[model samples]
Target: MNKLPYIFSLVVLLSTSFGPSSAQAQERRGWSPQAKGAVIGAGSGAVLGAVINKRNRAVGGVVGGVAGGAVGYGVGKHIDNKQKERARIAAANRAAAARNAEYRRSLARRNARQTVAPTRLQPAAMPGNSLVAGSAAMAYDAQGNPVPYASNAAYLPNDAYGDASHPYSTSEYRRKSW
Candidate 1:
């Protein structure tokens, strides 16, 4: 009364994969949760059924294995659904984070354009070096910074080179006192 072969055959029938019938691989690679659960359930049920049913052990094993496999499949399906849902949420969060980072970068660029202005360098130079205000006042380029005014114009303090009616100017304004 060796029921080993019968029990093995019954297990094979209840399992998700019986044998490789197709050439292309399956989409969900490896043993799915359902397949794993069913195999585990069938093996455990067969042993339990045989132990419990003193007589007609073979029939008991077959019936118990089928019932156990069905239950295991259901549980595995639930788990699979949860995993898929979690993956979807994670993808959404990643997309939102990327969008946020892009927005921040755009804001920083806009602010830089509005708040920072091209700096004015040392005053422009005059001939005869009458005013060495910052140099003859031979002005230097704004080292990588932008220059706002014309380079040739002499920008002197006290209107020394320009309008003579300035508050601090004397008629000797253009004269080189130094």
Candidate 2:
């Protein structure tokens, strides 16, 4: 059984060596611009022989050189095309990242603006500013001192509804109402 396997391997090697198909040749040999140029040169040399000279060596050489030059140019063009595509993709990626960063920055700014209160936009109101000052002419006693009256009270009593220690409520000042 081992001898049979060895025989099979030898047969495969021989088949590969003698293979007529270009695909097989391509697999065995790597594809390159230099190799393609050599093949084109050989083919052009054979085709141009009869027309240029009966002996044809000079014409064949010239034709082969031209074909090789063309093949080399084509290889160079293929390489340049690949490089251009890669450059375009890199530029597009950069543009997309810039746009995304700008969007995030704007969103962050908007969110910060929303979080802060607009305290400076409106005027502050005070609790006692609206109350009229009492006239001393109406309330003066015989000694010329102003008489104390119940109307002079700044606020009505809240009774026992609020905390005993915190007798004044801030809500009345905030709204500026007695």
TM-score, candidate number 1: 0.51
The per-residue C-alpha lDDT of model 2 at residue 110 equals 92
TM-score of each: 0.51, 0.35
Q: Note the Cα lDDT for every prediction shown.
A: 0.66, 0.57
The alpha-carbon deviation from the true structure for residue 56 of candidate 1, after best TM-score superposition, in angstroms, is 0.9
lDDT of 1 at 80: 87
lDDT of 2 by residue, 1-178 (tens): 7479659967997998686766654546565645565556555654564346557665665665566566655765676678789999999999999999999999999998865432222222323533545431224444455443333445443443455465464333212254
